[model samples]
Target: MEIHFTKMNGAGNDFVVIDNRSGIYDDLTKEQIERLCDRHRGVGADGMLAIEQPVEGSSSQYRFRYYNADGGEAEMCGNGARCFARFARNLTTEFEDEISFDTIAGPLVATFPGEDVCIDMSDPFDIESDIELSLSGTPQTVHFMNTGVPHVVLPVADVTAVDIVAVGRELRFHEHFAPAGTNANIHHVIENGHIRLRTYERGVEGETLACGTGVVANALVHHQLTGAASPIAVDVQGGDTLKVEFEKDADGNYRNVKLIGPADFVFDGTISI
Candidate 1:
C-alpha cells in the first residue's frame, strides 16, 4: 500500500501528516504506525497525524487523530494540532488563517494570527499540587494536571542537567499516574510570565525539542503558584519559543487557554507499506 504524507514541525516536534478522509487508512496496525515513526527504518517523526472525516454533528472541518511514535493513540498533541491546522488549511480552500478540528479530547479552534498558529485549547483539569513522588529514594514534590493529557511538573534548577530520559521515565511509569502513565516535564522559572521547559512525553517515551501541552502545563502551574498573568513566554528544549495565554478566575480554574507556536512544512512524500 502506498500512502501520501506531509512532514511538518511545530517548535521542532515533528509529525507525519496523512490525509485519511477516504477512510482507507483508518485501520493501520499499531506496528505499521510504529514503523512509520521509526527514526532508523521509517520516515522518522515524533508521531503521525491522520486527517479523518468529521464526526457526526461536528462543526470542525475535519477530525485529527494522533498516534505516538510507539503507535498508541493519544487524545491530543499541542504541536501536532498546529501542524494539522496548517495541513488542513493548505488543502481546505475555504479556510483562511483559522480552522477547527475535532479530536478525542474535544473540538479545538485554531487561528493563524500571523506566522504562528494559535490553538484554543481545552480547560486544564485534575489539578493537584505538591504530590509526593519517590525520585531515586528521595522525595520530590511534583504538581499534576491534565492538559488534554495528563502531565506532572517537577520544578528543577537546570533543565539541561536533568537526565530526562531516566528521571522522566521513572516518573512517567510511577504508580501515581499508573495504568496509563503520564508525561513528565522539567520546569524552570525564568521569572513571572517566563519559564524554560523540557518534557518526556508518554507515547514518544522520551524528551523531544518541545511539547505543546507540557508548555501549557508549565505556564498554568506557574500561574497557580506565582499569581502571574496570561500570555506566558515559555522557552522549550528545541530552542523555539512558545506563548501560552489563559484566563484564570478567582478559584484558580483556567479557561480560554491558547497555545501559540510555529508550524512549518518540512516536505511531502509517499511511501509503500
Candidate 2:
C-alpha cells in the first residue's frame, strides 16, 4: 500500500499522521505498523495516526486512531493528539481557530492558540496505590495512575541516571500486571515547583522525547504530594516545556486536567509499505 503521511512532532515526540477520512485505508496488521515505525528501515516514528470519520452518534467531525510503534492500539496519547490537531489544521485550507476530535478516550478539544496546540484532556482515572517493582535487580517504589491512559511514575533522584530502556521493559512486562501492561515514567522534582522527566511508553516501548499524558500524571502526583498550584511546568528530556493544569475537587480527586505543548509539522512524504 502507498501511504501518504505528514511527519509531526510535539516537544520532539514524533508521529506519522495519515488522513483516512475517506476510508481509503483498511485494517492494518500489527507487523505493518511495527515495520513502519522502525527508525532505520521505515518511516521512523513513535506511532502512526489515522484521522477517520467520527464514530456513531459522535458530535465531532473526526476521530483519531493511534497505533504504537509495535502496531498495538492505544486509547489516547497526549503528544499524538497534539500532532494530530496540527496536521489536521495544515490539511484544511479553511482557517479554523479551534477544533474538536474524538478518540478512544472520548471527545477532545484542541485549540490552535497562535503557534502552539493546547488540548483539553479528559479527566484522569484509576488513581491507585503506590507499589514497588523490581527493575534492574533493584526494588523501586512507583506510583500508578491513568491520565487518559495507565502510567507508572517513579520518582528518581537524577532523571538520566536510571537505565530507562532496561528497567522500563522489565516493568512493562511485569507478571503482576500481565497481558496489558503500562507505560513507565521516571521523574525528578527539579524544584518545589517544577519536574524533569522521561517516559517509556507502552506501545512505543522506549523513552520518547516527550510524553503529554506522562507529564500530566507526574504533575498530578506532584500536586498531590506538595499541594502545588495549577499550571505546573514540566521540563522533558526532549528540551521542551509542557504546561499542565487541573482542578482538584473537594474530595482531592483530579478534574479538568489539560496539557499544553508545542506541536509542529516536520515534513510530508509518501511511502510504500
Candidate 3:
C-alpha cells in the first residue's frame, strides 16, 4: 500500500502525519505503526498522527489519533498536537486563528499567535508530591502529575549532568506507577522564569530533543515549588525553546494550561507498506 504522508516537527519532536479522512488504513496494526516510526526501517518519527473525521456533534473542529514509536496509542502529546495543528491548517483552506480538535483524552484547542502554535492543554490534575524512591541506594523525592498524560518530575541541580536514561528508565517503570508506566523528567531551575529539562518519554522509551507535555509538567512542578508564574520559558534537549502559560485556580490547581512553541514543516513523500 502506498500511503501519502507529511513529516513535521515541533521544537525537535517529529511526527508522521496522515490525513486518514478516507479511513484507508482504519485497521492499522501496532506492528505497522511501529514500523512506520522506526528510525532505521521506516519514516522515523517520534510518533504518528492520523487526522480522522470528528464524531457527531463532537464540538471539535477535527479528530486526531496519536501513536507512539512503540505502536502504543497516546492520550495527548503537547509537541505533536502543535504539529497536528499546523498540519491541519495545511490541509484545509478554512484557516482560522483558533482550531479545536478531539483526542482520546478529550477536546483541545490550538491557536497561532505568530509562527509558533500554542495549544490550550486543558487542566492538570492527580498531583502527588515528594514521592519517595530509591535510586542507587539513596532516597530521592519526585513530584508527579497528569497534564493530559502521566509524568513524574525530578528536580536536579544539574539537568545535563544527570543520567536521564538510567534514572528516567528506573522511575518510569517504578512500582508507584506500575501497570501503565509514567514518563520521567529531570529538570533544573535556572531562575524564576527559566528552566532546563530532559525527559524519558514512556512510548518513545528514550529521550528526545523536546517534549511538549513534559515541558508543561516541569514548569507546573516548578510553579508549585517556587510560586513561579505562567509564561515560563523552558529549554529542551533540543536547541529550541518552548513557553508554557497557565492560570491557577483558587484550589491551587492549574487550568487554562497553554504550550507555545514552533511547529515547522520538514518534508512530504509517499511510502509503501
Candidate 4:
C-alpha cells in the first residue's frame, strides 16, 4: 500500500502523521510502523500520529492515536497532540482556530495562538514526591507523576552533565515503577519558573530532542519543590523552549494544565509500504 503522510514536530520532537479517518491504514502492523520510524531506513521520527474519526456519540472533532518509534501504542503524547491538531486543521475544513480530539487518556482541546499550538491537557494524577530510588548503586530522590502517562523526574545540578541515556534507562526500568515502567527526565531549574530538561522516552527507548509529557512532568515537579508559579518555561534538549501552565487546586492537585509549543510542518510525501 502507498501512504501519504505529513511530517511535523513540536519543539523538535518529530512525528510522522497520517490521515486515517477512512480507516485505509487501519491494518498497519507494528513492524510497518517501526520501519516507517527507522532513522536509517525510513522517514525518521520520534513517533507516529493517526487522525481518525471520533467514536460514535462523542463530541470530539476527531480521535488521536499515537505510536512510539518502537511501534507500541501509548495512552497519550503531548507533542504528538499538538502536531495532530495542526495537521488536522490544515487537512480538514471543519477546524477553525481550535479543535478537540479524543485519546485513550481522554478528550483534549488544542488551539492555535500565533505560531504556537496550545493543548489543554488532562488533569494530572498519581503524584508522589521525595521518593528515594537507587540509581547506579547510589540512593537518589526523584519525583513521580502521571500526565497522561507515567514519568519520573530527577532534579540535577547540571542537565548537560548527566549521561541521559544510561541513567535514564536505569530510571525508566527501575523497580519502583516496574511492570509498566516510566519515562525518565533530568532537569535543572534555571530560575524560579524556568528550567532546562532532557528526557529518555519510554517507547522510543532513547533520548529525543524533547518529550512533551516529560516537559510538563518536570515543570509540575519544579513547582512542588520550589513553589514556582504557573506558566513555566522549559528549555528542552531540542534547542527549543516549550511552556507549561497549570493551576493548583484547593486539594493542591494540578488542573487546567496546558502545554504550549510550536508544531511545525516539515514536509509531505507518499511512500509504498
TM-score of each: 0.98, 0.95, 0.98, 0.99
lDDT of 1 by residue, 1-273 (tens): 777899999999999999999998977999999989999988999999999989988788899999999999999999999999988999958989678999898999999888999999999899999899889999999999999999999999888888999999999999999898899999888888899999999999999999899999989998877888889999998899999999977886898999999999999999886
State model 1's lDDT.
0.92
Root-mean-square deviation of candidate 3: 0.9
Per-residue lDDT of candidate 4, residues 172-232 (tens digit): 9999998999999999989999999999999999999988999999999999999999999
Instruction: Name the candidate that leads on lDDT.
Output: 4
Best by TM-score: 4
| Global CA lDDT computed for model 3 | 0.91
Backbone clash pairs in model 3 (N, Cα, C under 3 Å; residues 3+ apart or in different chains), count: 0
Off by over 4 Å in 1: none
Candidate 4, residue 225: how far the Cα is off, in Å: 0.4
Residues 62-119, model 2: lDDT tens digits: 7999998989889999999998888787768563877789998889988877777889
lDDT of 4 at 99: 99
List lDDT for all candidates, in order.
Answer: 0.92, 0.85, 0.91, 0.94
Let me know the TM-score candidate 1 reaches against the reference structure.
0.98
Off by over 4 Å in 2: 93-95
Minimum summed lDDT over a 10-residue window in model 1 is located at 90-99
lDDT of 2: 0.85
